[model samples]
Target: MTSTVGVSGAGTQDYDVIVVGARCAGAPAALLLARLGHRVLLVDRATFPSDTISTHLIHPPGLAALERWGLLDRVVGTGCPAIDIYAFDLGPFVLAGSPAGEGFDVSYAPRRTVLDKILVDAAAESGAEVREGFTVEEILVDGGTVTGIRGHDKDGGTTIDRARIVVGADGLHSTVAKATAATSYAEKPKINAYYYTYWAGLPMYGQFEAFDRED
Candidate 1:
């Protein structure tokens, strides 16, 4: 039987949307949702301004999205240099050009530590609850549909964050994805690998370079 809902369970409905992984993708989504007046909960296993292994460059399209979300200035303000040129070194040939057209005349390669915090801060400014260093332990499911998440905090305290919808913005090895039994169709094996490290006082600050080598 369908019963009338009341505010008594409002406390249990912790949020309208609970977003896991407060990085680039998840943070922006939470920010937009919060700006639309929805109660959003953004959680991440790591703290903000933390470094993660990934490409730092945000292309023109991504830059446009940040601009639309009113965060471009904040990201650029972090002292990340603007990239207006691209160079590709193919084994036998080299290709280069300014791909950013009109609205997007440049790109930014801010460190994840800088970029993520800007997004998380924006999400908080938009009214989304932000929590860091919280690890999701389980995805709560009711009968079949996902309802919330069970996570543990830094102090080993467990908490259940219930929401009307749950989003997994976690990276490739997302725990939420595993809990939800999501399918994967990786058609090709990883053909290459790259590593990143800190560098200082070198040239080429505002340019994109892609070098292709035959191994």
Candidate 2:
């Protein structure tokens, strides 16, 4: 059975679902739940138009999902160009082709700042309560089952939200995963270091290029 808890005289506030990390995964899940008429609370530690370290590339299948969710137009409306060509250089060989799939013939590399905000907006518009800059400090658990989350808002105010279901969509180093002991393969170490920044007027915008560098 699902349980709920109240915080700070909020009059027993409760939701059907509570989602942490309002990015690609969390926002979409929350949007779906809200569209299904479930009360949802979507929280994120970052504000809109803020950057996150991401490759931001969405393949045809991902584009198809976005289209099904009615968000592809919004993504393209942000002026993010679509990439149809792919090139891979393996030093001794080269492979170039365009990916074709149902309802999508290309891929996209929208900026993270723009993409994430669009997802969050869609979740909000679908009736999910979204809280930006809300940091999840703890995952509430009982009898070995996840219940909800305790966190802080942007104003540094503490908040304890409860729901029937709690989803941790936080990225790789997820707090919920750690608190629930749900992680594996901890022995793997970082392999490479990557540094990237956006630049304007790059002619390679609509082209996907990959290089194999051994140095």
Candidate 3:
């Protein structure tokens, strides 16, 4: 399925990039490309402000990227705390939050929903044509290279975006990666024997039980 919308360009002929997925990686990539003056089509399966399960830990690199994109203010304003590091010799830690690197904020911690929304907005602000509520159906190709993508969207109905570069930021199970024959997931990777969980929104407590999904 392909969505037909009022695509504004040099007569809807093509785009510089087509990014599948619009979360952390895809969204940032799309925004960066758009900021570089590339006509980008950013698609994702979820709408803005979607709920998700995550620790919302942003690495220093990601924080730098946000600042580079000039969206640092949004992040700070979203109540996402600035955390310097969590040096846990063993107990639930404290906010050792500090600015100790390159005069840049070396801290991060926010709800995944808030952080994700921030990135999604940044992608749009990067001049990327953002389309949410869309599922990537397939990666269009030619001569063993990426050409575009086809998918079904919520508002635009169906979508067939053509671009010179098609980036797969769709996460672990990536269709673009699969169709392009670029990468594969390995089942033999080391797995953690221990597990953990958090009683979010619950009082900052002193005691809690332990469990895992398989338990």
**lDDT for residue 205 in candidate 3, whole number 0-100:** 25
Top-TM-score structure, candidate number: 1
The Cα local distance difference test for each model comes to: 0.82, 0.82, 0.69
Candidate 3 lDDT by residue in tens digits, 47-81: 98886654466666667767888987898898645
User: What are the TM-scores, per candidate, against the unseen true structure?
Assistant: 0.90, 0.88, 0.75
* Rank by TM-score (best first): 1, 2, 3
Q: Per model, how many backbone clashes are there? A: 0, 0, 4
Q: Which portions of model 1 miss their true places by more than 4 Å?
A: 1-12, 185-188
Worst 10 residues of 3 by lDDT: 1-10
Candidate 3 local Cα displacement, residue 64, angstroms: 2.2
User: Ten consecutive residues with minimal summed lDDT in candidate 2?
Assistant: 1-10
Error of 3 at 73 (Å): 1.4
> Candidate 3: deviation at residue 124, Å?
1.2
lDDT at 50 for candidate 1? Answer: 97
TM-score computed on alpha carbons, candidate 1: 0.90
Candidate 2, which segments miss by more than 4 Å at Cα?
A: 1-13, 183-191
Distance from true position, residue 198, model 3, in Å?
A: 5.8
lDDT of 1 by residue, 1-215 (tens): 01111111233577888888888888888899999999999999899779989768888888888889988888888877889889899979989887575489788898888988898999999999999999999888776667788999898999998888788888877776777677666457888989788788888656788998886
